[model samples]
Target: MFNFGIFLLLLGAVLVYATVPIIKIFNITTTKGILVVKLSGLALAVIGAIIMFFAQFPQRLEFLRLI
Candidate 1:
């Protein structure tokens, strides 16, 4: 779980980091394009945070122990 969380966090961070240049490259100055990029980035970040949070729960420890 911890590993998964770390992976997700890193993936999300990378997605957000990479998106900046992509938006710039496409000249995404329009309101719609800007909104799309921002929303996607925000969604990724949220998913990453959720993964990390779940990884820290006691229930996850018990599940791991069962394995």
Candidate 2:
């Protein structure tokens, strides 16, 4: 889970950084296609962040409970 979350975060970052190029590689040939791909990248990044949050939730809860 940890590794996958990290990988997703990186993938999202790359996708966002190279939105148009990646879209072209996928053979989505439209000038406005970048908008959808960029949105998907943002969604992936948010999902990855959620995964990472859950992955560390136990430890965080433990620490919080210590208070």
Candidate 3:
């Protein structure tokens, strides 16, 4: 669980970092694509943070261990 959480966080960070360069390279000044990318990145980061946070809790850790 902890490992998964860390993986998710890293993946999210990578996605955000990667997408930024592409957007910049293409000169994506339009609101649509930029908004979509931003929203997706935000969602991914939030999900990753939530997973990491729950993984740190003792009860959640125990529950995860059971799985």
Candidate 4:
């Protein structure tokens, strides 16, 4: 799970870093389309971070009863 999270984080970073090229590759021009890609990357990074955080602190997960 932890490793998966790291992978997701890296993937998200790549998506974000290559947004422009991605846009060009997909020919995305609309503002909404651009925003969706950006937000998707951000969401992945956040979810990955949250996973890593919980993995590192199991007690916190239990405390929050999130799992």
User: What are the C-alpha RMSDs, in order, of all predicted structures?
Assistant: 6.0, 4.4, 6.0, 5.9
Better of 3 and 4 by lDDT: 4
Tell me the tens digit of each residue's lDDT in model 3 across 1-67. Answer: 5567677777777667788786988888888988777677777777878887767556545665534
For model 1, the run of ten residues with the poorest summed lDDT: 58-67
Score every model by TM-score: 0.53, 0.67, 0.56, 0.78
Model 2: lDDT to the true structure: 0.75
lDDT of 2 by residue, 1-67 (tens): 7557777888888889997678767988776787788877888888888786667545444665333
lDDT winner: 4
Q: Write the number of the candidate with greater lDDT, choosing between 2 and 4.
A: 4
- For model 3, the superposed segments whose C-alpha errors exceed 4 Å read 17-19, 24-29, 56-67
Candidate 4 residue spans exceeding 4 A from truth: 56-67
TM-score (C-alpha) between model 1 and the true structure: 0.53
Candidate 2 Cα errors over 4 Å, as ranges: 24-31, 57-67
Report lDDT (CA) for all predictions. 0.70, 0.75, 0.73, 0.82
Kindly indicate the candidate among 1 and 4 with the higher TM-score. 4
* Model 4 residue pairs with clashes: none
